[model samples]
Target: MKNCSNFTNDVVYSIIISFISVSCIYGQIPVENDTIEDIEDFDIIDMESTLVEEKKDSISWVSDVFSAMRLGIQYGFTYKAEKPDKIMNNRFSFRLEYSKSFLEYLSVHIDTKMFTFLKNDHRIRDEEDIVALEGRTREAYLQTSFNKTSIKAGIQIVVWGESDYAIVTNEIGRLDYREPLSLNMDDLRIGQPMLTIDQYSSFGYWSAFFVPYSEFNEQPRKGTGYYYDPFDGKVEYLKEKQKGNFSEYGLRWRKTFGKSDISIMAASLIDNQYALRMVNPDLITKSKQRFFMTGVTFNRAINNLLVKGEVAIKSEKAYNDASFQIVKKNALDASLGVDYSPNSTFTLSIEAVNYHIMDWSDQIQGIPRNNYIALLALSKQLMKNNLSLSWASMYNGPYTNFFNVLSASYNWNDHITLNFDALIPIVDDARSGFYPYRDQKQVAFRVLYQL
Candidate 1:
């Protein structure tokens, strides 16, 4: 193994410094107390009472500060169903979320995540071989509002659609697809640096955002369980093309009327997911394409039922043909979702989504001409709402590929939580789509502590 002694030492020191700094900043504030006195000392007792009152005031301020800051520590373990002795992942993570207000109309927010590996795995390469430490600044932004207008700048995550199961119009931000079945919606989002402005008028609400440089999706690393390699790890992969250093800009208009809300959006951006193009027989590389997209979304609440829908059209979307050449074509995406909730404890959601390549041809190898997907989800709260259980499934009609998740979460106390999940992916049509992830069935357990 190549020597990484210096790098390892630096990582350890950085972790120690970070932990100490956080502890000193938010763990507790020390207050000095006077010496205790005997019962005969009445004057000292009075002074002690005064000091106690002052301490109480100081403690109140500390509590207020604590309320604005939150820290979450989590440890997660995943076991492969096919091989009990092999571990898929054993990791620990720390997350911090904070919000503070200065002037009356100005505020700042931050969210960060740090992770360290406790087990050696093939997912990470040699440089990050053992005890790999990774960090991400999910969001860090400053926001200010004046009258009916608000502006924000910094790294941020923005969702721009109404569909929960389908990303019909929510393509503005990059996403993490490393653990698609295990991670939640919020966890999959990746923040991007951007400037945004919003204005409220009598007619509607208008919003705009500009990203100086956009980022692509974070795909699973090579040698991971979910990573896809068409050549079965036999080829030398080349560097991807046009992956970054591009701008993204978008506009949106939204309004709420009675029980209904509607939004219209448009953007010019690069696709976060890349398409593979064959450079040679032994070399395959990825490429990102730019496109213009426009969409509309709406939702209506009627008593115990909610209806949502979205429609989007992309101009000159890129894909790979059967000959392994990049091709651009127009595409249309649409989704309709319905949610039924008779009470606060139980809910059911169903959605149908479609992606159609306009002027379809048989030469497209990456996607079908008319791809259809369906989603079903059910969730319930139990044990006085301290425990939650959910089941969700997504099925692709054309390729007979599907994924299922069964999860449960229990709040052990105010600051601790336990979670368990079973993730299963089924691929029946080997000729239609990539099935490299079909054998990744696993069960995961996690413990979270929040302050």
Candidate 2:
């Protein structure tokens, strides 16, 4: 993606693109009403009446065309607590989506997003500038359905697993880690291009996917508040490029029984997280290793309580030693969560996660052999469900790191919404990833309008 600093033009361009693309792709829009008249009893008055009806029909068609398309726009900003006058993020975003069914068994969908970063400052590095105009096609796909089977191709988002807060098996889609602590959970995923086949049978629902060109996680740019500096001194960094092969595939089978759901999945893929390879004390390179992973997830609802868990085993995972040398080891990841909802307006969720490296070694550079994390979330709605309030907290067991977020959202009406979020990070150990921005507490405000 290319970045430009023209904010007004970018916003106008996004609006024009949405309308033009939708009109062009649809070509002929179907109208529901048909005006009929009698020719034998026609006169000048009847002719004028018929012409007026035709004009109304034309207006109705245009209205229907515009109403059928989905459009949304959002503007938000974050303010740092330490530097009250400084703005951390000022973003304006637009989204457009259009879907159509061409045949009984074939359909297509297009979703696009545009973002304009209105903040320009020193924190935004020149090497990888984050403050500018950017756009992406969130999803553009064609699908065919036959009886109990369906096939889809194009850019898409796939979600797998049952645990919340901790990612155990939902590794198929890449995640955005650029502003890890500030982003909402629902907006953290980035779409990937792939072909998928899903089949429904008496046994279960089977799904298989092939990603020809898989992508890695979106990391923070250098000089950003969230960027992590591994080495203190200057070091040369290099990334190894894959020559010709770029493929990742996975299979999943899910079944439902009463109020319970279970799924098992396996994949051969390159890790999204990179490992450092030390060329020397002053040189280090970021690289990813291929690995095999298999996992299972299940969720069951009982009374007012819901329980979910996931466990995965990965072979030949990549890691860095104390000397920054690369090492391969097996690892196990597991997470369990429980939700208690006493009423429709209030809910609480608690989760625990663990990551263990087999063939343990104390020489691991950043991660401990056994890492544990605890999470808690509570949410409530009031004002006839127009106002929502939530609080989420996370704690690292070994590092004594603590992170918390408080959020509130209010619906002004059917088309407008206002949101506010506060993020707080307490770093007890310098080894913790959150230590880099220990003093960067922030409060964010957002307004969204649907068109």
Candidate 3:
């Protein structure tokens, strides 16, 4: 605690001052308003009219196009918690995004990021992969609107759950696990190629998605710092599927009742998570399995507490047995969460999750029979949300294990911010879920400047 407290104080002071200085300089630059014109008075109605005119003249669906740009730079350092060698987790990252609405029916958005690690870069393979540039599409997509129907096409990140993190009903896209024990849950998602169509009506909204291309989530290679890799310098690969099908599709129906948001969704697609199938002399391989998934989610507020829940059923799940044979099973998972905002700056949330298999096989020793997990999250904002702190913990019932995260964020201004995060785990010495890297405690910090 002493070390962490000292690190937090030092980094917060230096980063806040430096970031605010830069933001002030940037904001002081003389930049005139884009929609400037001769107006009679500063009345609210006149200002609204001016904004409407600006949208009508320049951008059809948006007020301004140049305000779509977002840029940021961040740096962090991490490593194994126990006896570790030299520094292996030093990383630098950059991000950029631009979006615009060109016509009444069409709009385009593009986002991308790059990563550079200074030393002991586990993701790097030889010289080519060093300082890799990833998330190129981040979310490059095009949208069109016609009547009550809208369509979005191209590579995009599609999330379909009401949960804050550890999503249960979200089964459309893949997850990126290169950086494990991360504080930002959204950063863990990776986009896929899909075309979505939505039609709105008084009853509700009906949405459909077509996902043709199929690929599993990326994993750490043999040389990566991720504990999953055996570190034999051999690649961790996935076995080829018998055939690639282009008919994967999903459907979602959502509606609002009073103050409750309810949604039901279904999808038939190849699952992104893979299970170890066979082992070769030089290569470790996994296999992907197709699944039919359906779920219902809801959110509502009563008094000062907000309640959220989702239940998902999977028709097929791939796993391994002691005999090394891949077993397919049906699974059901559900989560219920409640959040209470006792005051303006503090909030507390409690969530319960349960998972069960419809049919259990004695041969299946690798998979847990059932699970009862509880998650508690607390967050507070100070200085009018300019300074914030969040702490969350997840307890695994069967294994008696815990996963905890504590993070602090300081907004130097509208454009610059600093973040510090610590990941701590409590588990038995024997292997359990999240057993690997259980002792690899991590503390990471990043400063971002964006507009």
Q: What TM-score do all the candidates reach, one by one?
A: 0.84, 0.85, 0.80
Candidate 1: deviation at residue 200, Å? 1.5
Q: For candidate 2, what is the lDDT?
A: 0.81
Predict model 3's lDDT versus the native.
0.76
Which 10 consecutive residues of model 1 have the lowest summed lDDT? 34-43
Best by TM-score: 2
**Candidate 3 pairs with clashing backbones:** none
lDDT (Cα, tens digit) per residue for candidate 3, span 254-335: 9999889999999997878776665755555666678899999999989889999999999878877875667889999999
lDDT of 2 at 326: 86
**177: Cα error in model 3, Å:** 0.6
Q: Put down candidate 2 lDDT per residue, 1-451, tens digits, no spaces.
A: 1133235445754675556445444543433562222222233345446555765676576676666589989988888787534677778889998876665899888888998876543245563665777787768999999999999999998878776577778878888888778525457778889999999999999999999976888887787656776665488788866576568899999999999999999998878887778788778888767888899999999999999999999999998887778889999999999999999999999999998999978777788888899999999999999999999999986877899999999999999999999999988698787787788788889999998
| Candidate 1, superposed: residue stretches over 4 Å from native | 1-64, 83-85, 127-129, 239-245, 431-434
* Candidate 2 residue-wise lDDT at 370: 80
Q: Is candidate 2 or candidate 3 better by lDDT?
A: 2
- Whole-model lDDT per candidate: 0.83, 0.81, 0.76
At residue 193, candidate 1 shows an lDDT of: 94
> Tell me, what's the RMSD of every candidate?
10.4, 9.7, 13.3
